[model samples]
Structure formats: structure tokens, C-alpha cells
Target: MTRYLEGQTAIVTGGMRGIGLGIARRLHSAGAQIVIWDLAVDGWDSVANGFEPVMRQAVNVASLASVEAGFKEVVAQQGRVDILVNNAGINGPVTPCWEYPPAAWDQVIAIDLTGVFYCCRTVIPHMRERGYGRIVNVASMAGKDGVQYISGYSAAKAGVIAFTKAAAKELAQDGVLLNCIAPAMVETGLMAEMTPEHIAASKAKIPMGRFLQIEEIANMVTWIAGPECSFTTGFVFDLSGGRATY
Candidate 1:
């Protein structure tokens, strides 16, 4: 059987756990070499099984220096990066916009929005040089609908979606495709931070009346990361389970 992603190298930020882990597993199953860039180094060993000898890098996505150093190491080890999944993010504090903390806001923006930019900015040149690349940024439905009490997270994810569009246009002619996925609530560690009331409210909003499974998101990402996804750059793929109106 010919693997769809054989011989490709992929970098998945926050790949140590949760949705990112699911993505890494799927891509690896498709035969891509996995490099997980995350702050949690200990979990890599468990997730590394069955992948093509996964590379683990302890990276703080919020810092450009950290991202640069991590990517440099990735290049040193793998020699190339064919796909990038910008999946690192934090929900910050769940509070009204007026009550949101400045520090918390900055933290969310740094990790969820600016971090994606940093990864793209660092890897895009390499992708352009190679004349091939697939970049997937993970945004959220909150970005589109502006969920109440999570202003910081919503705004940051919105920025990610916007950035994906702008960057995709800039690189459209360069053979490097960039797109983002806006998913509704998923059952991940991030949900642990939300109050039960908040979780229930989010579920009620989804027409499907359920949280998305990680594998569903992974399957969508797998397709988007493959060659068959050609000609679909600069767009947002909705994974909202009927919650997204646009």
C-alpha cells in the first residue's frame, strides 16, 4: 500500500497531547515523519510508538527565539519540513471582556495567535525553498462566534484565522499552501479548564449537540495535509458540527 504522506516530514506544535497528538498519530499512520514541538517532553515517548522515530523538542511557542531554535534543530535532524500543524494554544481565563486581565490577554494572544505566526514565519522560507509545503493552523468556532466569557481566547483564535488567510494569499504563488480549521468544542484537556456550565452551554449551541471527537478533527487534518488538497489555499475548513453559520 502506498502511503499518502510517505517521505514527508511534519512538525506539529503541541503534539505531545490532545488534538495535536491525534493529528500526529494520523499523519504518522499516513507515513509522515513526525516532529513534536511542545513544552511537555515526557509524554513524547508514549506517543512516539509506531511513528517514524518521532523527534521531541521542548519548545515554548509563545517565544520566537524558542520557535527558531526548535525549528533549527528539526532541520538539523530531519533535513526538511514538508508540513506544519500550528496546534499550540491556551484558553486563557474564562471571563468577560471588561474583566479580562491584561496579562492573561497577552498570554493567550502570544501562544494562540502570535505563536502560529512565529512558526509560519520561521518555516515558510524553508518551504518556499523546497517549493512544497502544507500548513494547518487550528482555530476555533469561538473565533467565528465570539463565545461569551472567553474574550481573550476568542480574539486570539480569530486572529489566527485572519492570519491564515493573509499568509495563504502571500504564499499562494509560492507552492506553499496555508489554511486553517475552525472546530467547535472538542473533548480535550483544554475543556478541563472550562466550567461545567460553560461546557454545557457550548454543547447546546452545537446543532449536533455533542463535542467533536479528536479523531474526526485528525481525519480532516489528514486530508488537508495531503496532495489531494491542492488548489484549496487561503480558506477556512469548518469542523463545527453544524454550529458555524458562515
Candidate 2:
């Protein structure tokens, strides 16, 4: 491993487990300081045993105030945040849109979509002032191709894809670069939240005949959040196993 990010610091929302955890571990292996932000992270120490200097903070991404406070705390301690991975999102409910509860829809939008907006809003100024930063928003293949029974998740992720593009353009002149990843149904704990039928349908859609692996997402993110990804921003990098045609 090349320790390319030797002195950089990275914040991974929902990083205590699953895909987020995989990404955090990979970034740490590359020598970037790791910060995990989640609603509850009780046993994080056991999982992050080798991650020396790993910091954990309680962050409810749905709240703008919480996002602001979390960013402030990271900056106050680390002096600066060089990378941010917005990976804290829910799968929402497995139900038809017509039958979806309004509250559930709002919650999905809040965490998956608006939450990205809030974090970026809070960090953009600081990154802009420093003239260097990297932000990787985790989106989904469902956002590009709507999945049945997961309308809320689909819509929210679509919003994330658009948000990444728009924000990247605004920061083009600055050293801050923003990009998003749209992965197919990834094998993670979040899949447990989906119905068997929903999972089956999603898997069948992938040309590779398998769900995406967490490490695959982590690999893509490692490069995107690193210094080599200089010329690309405002783009959606697909990890769909041939599911994404566009």
C-alpha cells in the first residue's frame, strides 16, 4: 500500500459498519486519519482496533445543526478535513410508492438527499478557504434506474447524484472536487432491510449476476478521494456491474 494520503484526514459518515466501514478501513490503510460519524457507535473500538487515532462522533446527518457541529468538532481537533464521504443513508421502506408512508418518504429524503446538502454546505467554505478538498457522495443504481418497492431510496439517491454534479461545478475553480458513486445493490447490512423479493429483483437486474461487494465501493472511493483524481469532478462513477447503461 502506497500511503498516498499520509497526512490527510477523512470523515466517513455511518462509517462504523458495512460499506462505510470498508471505506474507512481502506482510507486508514492509505494513511489518512479516520473519523467515524454515526448515530450509535458503541463497539467501534473493537472493529477499529488497528485504526490508531480513529475518532468517533455522534452525527445525525438529517439535522443541519448536527452536521455543522460535527464538522466544527472535526476541524477543531484535526485542524482541517481533507476528505468527506457522505455514506450515511437508509434503505427506506420496501413498499410501493402509493402505499409508502409520508413520514418514511420524508425521512429518506432528509438523510439520503438533504443530509448530503447539509454536510457540503457546512464544509464547502472551509475547503474553499484552504483551496483543497475531496467529497465523495455515495449514490445508488436505483437512482438512475428506479427500483420497484424502493421509491423513496431511489428518489433520494437521484437527488444526491444531481447535487454532486451541481456542487462540483460551483467548486471547479477551487481545489475542492466533488463526485458521486452509483453502485448496484451492494452486499451490506442494509440489504437486510430489504424484502427477499426486492433483493431478488435487484440482483437479477445486474448483468454480473451478483450483488456488488463493499470492497469494490471502497476501491473506487479510495481513488476518487485521493490526489490522483484531479481532472474529474461533477461525475457519477458507476459500480453497477453493467446495470447502469448511461
Clashes of each: 0, 0
lDDT of 1 by residue, 46-84 (tens): 534445445888999989999999999989988999999
Residue-by-residue lDDT tens digits, candidate 2, 1-246: 999999999999989888998899889989999999999877756544557445799999999999899888899999989999999999989998899999999999999999899988998899999999999999998888888899999999999999999999999999999999999988888878988988899899999999899888999999999999999999999998988879
> Positional deviation of 236 in candidate 2, in angstroms?
0.4
- Please list the C-alpha lDDT of all candidates, in the order they appear: 0.91, 0.91
Runs off by more than 4 Å, candidate 2: 46-50
Question: Which ranges of candidate 1 are over 4 A from the true structure?
Answer: 47-53
